[model samples]
Target: MAWYHTYFKGLPQRAWKLNQDEEYTDYEVDFLRDVLEITPDSKVLDVLAGYGRHAVPLATDGTALTCIDISQEYCEELQTTAGRGQLPIEVVCADVLNYALPAGQFDAAYCFGNSFSFFPRTEMQQFISQIASALKPGAHAAIHTENLAESILPNFQARNWMPVQDDIIYLAENEYRAEGGYIEAEQTFISGSEKVTHHVRQHIYTLGELTYMFEQAGLLVVGTFSNLEADPFQLGDEQLYLVARKQ
Candidate 1:
């Protein structure tokens, strides 16, 4: 299947070169910084670190990073970028569901931009375990996902602008099918050359289920919120940000 290639192998160029928001964004950049609570001595692991978007910046800011991705293309891009710089970023190209945990204690770990939902529940459990294995006791873990309730009803829809080119843009309308964590939609991109449609699907989990999964994985759900600001979660919130620590 092209799932790995489409999502990981091809991500770096599309993200950095094409300006995809998941890889390059000030808001998220700031958010992960806050999530890591980065320190000069922090050793961080970013699962599904694509295009080195988070790793490069985090490494620049002085946090030693080990970035794991499913795509060799992204790993190569990250390595090349690191070679062009002074910092050493550990980049691994392996399936997140199957990547072996690095053998070292880490200060913090994270999976941002809703990277976990790419797998079904069976894989999600193992993904959580792999993340926990990377951490020392009491190390913090943060996961950011789109609001869960919104996915339950699939009543949410929005049109947003994405920069497809220097002067061109793509108008994207996103929707979800609320039935049992199934979310599917389309993104139609309009530019001078062609009109392209991108199909998307993700399973959304509610707060209860999210916490339940974390606890099942032997991680304590210390807090849950709707925004990176750590605001209390409320229905209709735009996002679901969860924070935890290994038990």
Candidate 2:
């Protein structure tokens, strides 16, 4: 199994449950609506839509959504939620890189939750290209992730810990491979009496490098934000929210 499969498998349902909170869900939906300029009739594609965090709410509000994820468990859970709520969501369990999306099918698309850099450089390029191919001309794509600038910060820490929920604490240790231009992360999740660890490797890219890749894929960079609320991007911002339009 892939490292991500092992990692996501170990996470309990409660870990996914936290993202379903109304406050966070509302903010995510609003971000998509305002930033991506989505409407109730828009057809949206959500890449790596774990547990339907954004899918369910958007579908509930009458937007059409197609979600793809590698985890069958997450897909099943999302399907159940959508069924119960009678939301218009189609969940597909497949690796995003290998999945075949209908050409020019989506009006808008997004990949959230720091999911962008999981693949190596070449594969990441292809992944972006695939998204671009799936979008209608002039359609928008939003990517939310931790900025590479944070990894290169002078004050960067190799290890950190934070509580994601009342009972769940996440511990992360990182190593930067300057030669390879990637960062390797080992994450441990502790909840109650259970503990699980997952390893992730991500390619690090400067804003210019990312822009080049997106442009090569025919996705034109239009805006960059620090977060979902559209805060102006800065040099040292921890998170990057990039918006692009298909050419």
Candidate 3:
């Protein structure tokens, strides 16, 4: 089984949650709304929307959100949260590559939280194609990742540690495999007396490579930004946000 199959269950989930804050999420939501031209009547898809961080807010604003995530723990939490707030969110717990997306059903779609780097080339192409198929013609899609070649290669670190919370620390020991075009990492989350560790891998794709993949998927690469501020993507940027439109 893949590491991600069980990665998000225990301490990783807690660490991930701690890594994000309401202010940052709000900023990202605003950027998504503007970039996707979202409206109350729009139907949106949140690919791998763990815990409904973006879905809940967008749905609360009246955009219907269909969220798909593989983690049952996350799906249940999202379902309960949506139920409590009466948000228009549909949580689907399944691997995204296996899901049969409704053709032309969504006005916009997004894979945020650096989750876009999860798949290798072939599977990633299929993933993008599925999102394209689910989008109406001219509909847009956004993908965010920290594993973009230009963003990561220039600042690659062998090992790093960051505080997730006052008591929790997240450590990563990474190895880059140029032949495989992937980074394998041993990720550990330490909190108080408990420590949880997992091995994970993320594929690295350059801008040109990703653009070509988008083209092959019947989507046109429109813009690439380094941040939510809509700044053009450049080398040394910490993250990448790419927007494409269905052809």
Candidate 4:
């Protein structure tokens, strides 16, 4: 199994619960609805859907949703929930980088929760291209992730810990290699007597770099925000929420 599979496998139960907080999910759904201009007749794609935090709500709003994730457990859970709710959601378990998507099939698509930087630069470009290919011409694509600018900031922390839930804490140690434009992180989740660790390397891209990649993928940038709330992006922002349209 892939390293990420093991990493994410240990996270689903607690991570899903924390991420599926009602307020956060509602904000995300509203953000996507506005940015993607979603409607009841829209066909949407949620890559790296996890436990369907965004998918369920989007489907419940009457949009047709296709959710793809690497975790079979997450996919199964999402499938069961969609079935129980009789929502228009289709769940698929597959690696987003290589997953096959029907060309021009979607009206909008998104990858949230910092899932954009999972691969190296070349592979990341391919991932963007694949997303563009999956959407109809003029369809919007929204991507949310940590801003690379944060890594270059002087106040960047090499190690940090934060409470994720009642008894769970998340600890992260980061190493940024400027020359390679990548950040390697070791993350630990501590819950009572149990602890789990995972290592991940993410290619960090400047706004200009990301814009070039999106252009190469036939996705033209339309807007860039600091977050899902439509705040203007400025220097020192920690998160980037970019919107583009397939050409």
**Candidate whose lDDT is highest:** 3
Candidate with best TM-score: 3
Q: Which residues of candidate 4, in runs, are more than 4 Å off?
A: 11-13, 150-154
Q: What is candidate 1's lDDT per residue for 1-247, written digit by digit as tens?
A: 4243464422223533575555335666677677657687889998888777767877887789888887677788889998889776888887766667874488888887566567666777777887887788788888877647553344565666667557445565666654556556565555566555656666677778778888887789887777656788777777777889887
* TM-score, cand. 1 vs. native: 0.81
**Lowest lDDT block of 10, candidate 2:** 11-20
How much lDDT does each candidate structure score?
0.71, 0.83, 0.93, 0.84
Q: What is the per-residue lDDT of model 4 for residues 1-247, given as tens digits with 9 covering 90 to 100?
A: 4356555676535664674468877898899999999999999999888888888988988999999988777888899999999999989898877777999999999998777777778888988999999999999999988746553454677899888768788888999888888778898888889988888776778888889999999999999898666887777888888999999
Better of 1 and 3 by lDDT: 3
Ranking the candidates on TM-score from highest down gives 3, 4, 2, 1
Candidates 3 and 4, the one with greater TM-score: 3
TM for every model, in the order presented, reads: 0.81, 0.92, 0.98, 0.93
Name the lDDT value of residue 130 in candidate 2: 94
Query: Model 1 residue 1 lDDT?
Result: 49
Q: Which segments of candidate 1 are over 4 A away from where they belong?
A: 2-4, 8-35, 151-155, 158-180
CA RMSD of each candidate after superposition: 3.5, 2.0, 0.8, 1.8
lDDT (C-alpha) at residue 32 in model 2 = 84
Compared with the true structure, the alpha-carbon lDDT of candidate 4 equals 0.84
List clash counts for every candidate, in order. Answer: 0, 0, 0, 0
CA lDDT for candidate 2: 0.83
